[model samples]
Target: MNPVKTIQRLWLLFLLQIPFALMAQHPVRLAVAGITHGHSDWIYNRKLRGDIEIAGIYETNADRVQEFRKRYQLPENLFYTNLEQLLDKVKPEGVMAFGPVNEHIAVVRACAPRKINVMVEKPLATTYKDAQEIADLAKRYGIKVLTDFETSWYASNQYVRNSYKEGRLGQLRKVMINDGHEGPWAMNRHFVSWLTDPVKNGGGALMDFGCYGANLMTWLMEGQRPLSVTAVTHQNRPDRYPKVEDEATIILQYPEAQCVIQASWSWSFSRKDMEVYGTKGYAIAADPVKIRTRMQGASSEVSQTLEPRSAPFNDPFAVFANVIRGTLKLEPDDVYELPVNVTVVEILDAARTSAKSGKTIYLKPRPALVQAGNVGNN
Candidate 1:
């Protein structure tokens, strides 16, 4: 080849690489809706890291809008009075709905038709019908809908899931989990407003904190949908949480194992721990971020803890950004499929039904498990 021709071909190859490199570095633009939820702060801080831009913020309540603006030092132009105006102006690639549970459906409905990816705070919607509607809308539009079950993305949970896949826990038989904090009334004065309002919050502490237990249990058990769920609720602090139950104990039964999930807004003590018992070994963890395990024949327990590497928040905004950038695929949909946001809503609804009926409520039969070898095909 001629010397000049050889240099020209090399230049062409370098130019081709530039487009791919630039595309890899592009940021995802995200607009956040409803700044009243506590988790919104995490999203705000994480999005500031340069991978994502907080294009806009919307809140229905004027007071909340003012509070957020002052807290975050957001400019007036970036604040909108409602979701429709915000979406129209910003045209974000994704939206984080951090609104109240009752407002979730409306926000999702508004965004899904635009084919915007959305990450709704857990317990997708306040009611079963609304939850199903959101899921249906997203499916129709081919929008990726996810819940902010942040713990599911924790490194410790990933380690535990990997262990379960390796059969280290061996034929799981039972799980015991607790997720509680001081009652909402004591934790925040505003918590009692909509959270205790059955019309707005849907159920009670079960819908709020109980969903975490249900989601975590489902994730750890290889996505085994519960066959039946039975629950009991208590209103011990009726004066404080006037319209909502203060505590709840739930049992989720599967073909292979039974899970006990306890949630409360009345506990004076704070506890967040999980114990997994199986035919061969047992695993325990304070949160999904830390876990220890023991196998039947092992001489001693093996322990692992994931050091917090990022900010104090549990926001997975970077993960979402990577998904958009095509740098990382969504978590495998096998034993530990990334949860579809609506499924969390459905599980919470079932638990509430079981509690209300004073009897076990059976779920629709789950599809056959995607066996280990065939998991990736989906």
Candidate 2:
């Protein structure tokens, strides 16, 4: 072979290998703040994509840590019992909170100051106050704080949202979201403990599953605060979940539209679905990929199987890595954005108040704390 041709082929090969080399050498460093959350195993169970690296994990429970070590065959040096020590040592780009809902505040407080982003499961916090504080910390530190919801990545939901945004659904008149499972008891015992505790997980079904509706509605409304909130809660399973209500129905009245959220832990089957009605048409998201819709001219509802969302939007960890690496920008009312999740906590707060007082609770305004946080610009 000619030496010049050989040298040129080698140079081309080296150029093609550069991207793969960078992916292997500099995967996004991610830390786990807690391990008790049932969904915490997502990070370990996911097939390696070479885009994320588990830098460190901080869990107070040694047994849980051991269980994770044995299950995933992770090294002992990757675990830390103390949060601050882990943060200081690994200095990961982001931290995912897998503890109780109430613990989100502490995770944000620690990660924000360190200039590390955070992603927590579902509701941003147990209360509006904690949510506001997390938003404030994110704003102050210029870090991204995201809430992960399994429904957010649903292709059906995304299809509906896109159609609505494109004026195909017309003005949204009513939206109904149903989300829940049989109960937390059937899941991990540790998850059930905090999930049932009123203080740790907020109200039972209302906060656990209700947040899904609130989060989705807030996103559909473009982060607008509702006019008033009314809710009714019941302890259908008093024998099992005595400390908190097992079922809840929350109504949100807007100036031009309304929403009904049915959240229950007593469902015979697990489900996460939504029905959206507009002035000119309607769309029902029956599952992650199936949707039924009827437009004005359509004779009847039509069903469709939607394609899954593309990368960075399909996975929560992918989103965190993209945001931290400055490859993806979030919208003001993105389902996972801090502002939208903050409003979700606010709605839950009002729902709790309404349920207890048996009166409709009129929202005064978006709290000044939330407004001042500059969460939308993120």
Candidate 3:
């Protein structure tokens, strides 16, 4: 055979094998910590795509365990009643949490001791104290901890973040985010008991929807601590959400800029979007996949579409894989880090407190009642 023909045939064979090579590479070993939260579907869909292996799963509630198992048609053998047993047996490299937001600390505490990484659904924890404890554990164990925001994966959100970071919008002036939907009851979510429990879900819409604004604001401000936060939460349907607030508004006051976060479960329609106004222009994450921009003096808005992010930054599994392999370095000031999450949790906590006390809670010391304070006192 001619040498050129021989070389071409070999190259063709290699090309044919590349697809299998890529498919088998970078598969992350993962486990599930809770399935009660509706967000479990996000990770489950990733599992279907073979991005991560569901090494094991545990839930305190047997019914929940079985319900999820049957719902997803997961293998019965994968369920473990005890968390420790699952960890000891499967020994996954990471854990994805889908339980109540308040359970984050306890689950992280368990996984950290084994040097296993963890990814929790947004808001980090129900309180700042829990956030701190999880931070300490992650530090001691030398494991990565990430708080997964549905918005974090949004290309439009990143577009806004990069726009401000690059000073494309000039000096930052204000951030206005409106995120939420019609009531969960209206949608008939199956596992909403915890989502409506003030202790478990952590302040209803202010927590469920408000955290998106807090997380994005923290990232945009470059982790600058706010002077104070003022907020108000209301329960429009007291009979339905007697224990929690269904609608809430939080304001974060910085040195030169302010952010208004409106989160609610009571709305005319569903919405999860944001608007960022700077000194010279403004950008809006009109939706998850679209961005609309307007210059200061422009007569019309310029709309652009954003392509979804690629692997490592695209999904939890890919990101977790890069994290365990030491390829992705999440800075302490990064929005996903514990310190940032702590502040986010603190802001939410203060929002609830402000609603109860009807005062602007200053972060410097305590909520010293002031006659003229006006941030969250409204």
Task: Return the TM-score for each candidate structure.
Answer: 0.89, 0.93, 0.87
| Candidate models: Cα lDDT each | 0.73, 0.90, 0.80
Number of the top TM-score candidate: 2
lDDT of 3 by residue, 17-56 (tens): 9997786575678888988788787766663565577788
**lDDT tens digits, residue span 26-60, model 1:** 77899988776767778656435567888998876
- Which structure is stronger by TM-score: 1 or 2? 2
> Residue 187 of candidate 1: its Cα lDDT?
43
Ranking according to TM-score, highest score first:
2, 1, 3
- Deviation from native of the Cα of residue 320 in model 2, angstroms: 0.8
TM-score of 1: 0.89
Candidate 1 vs candidate 3, TM-score winner: 1
Over the stretch 9-126, how does candidate 2's per-residue lDDT look in tens digits? 9999999999987864688999999989999999988767888989999998887888889999999999998899999999998999999999999999998889899999989999
* Model 3: per-residue Cα lDDT at residue 332: 58
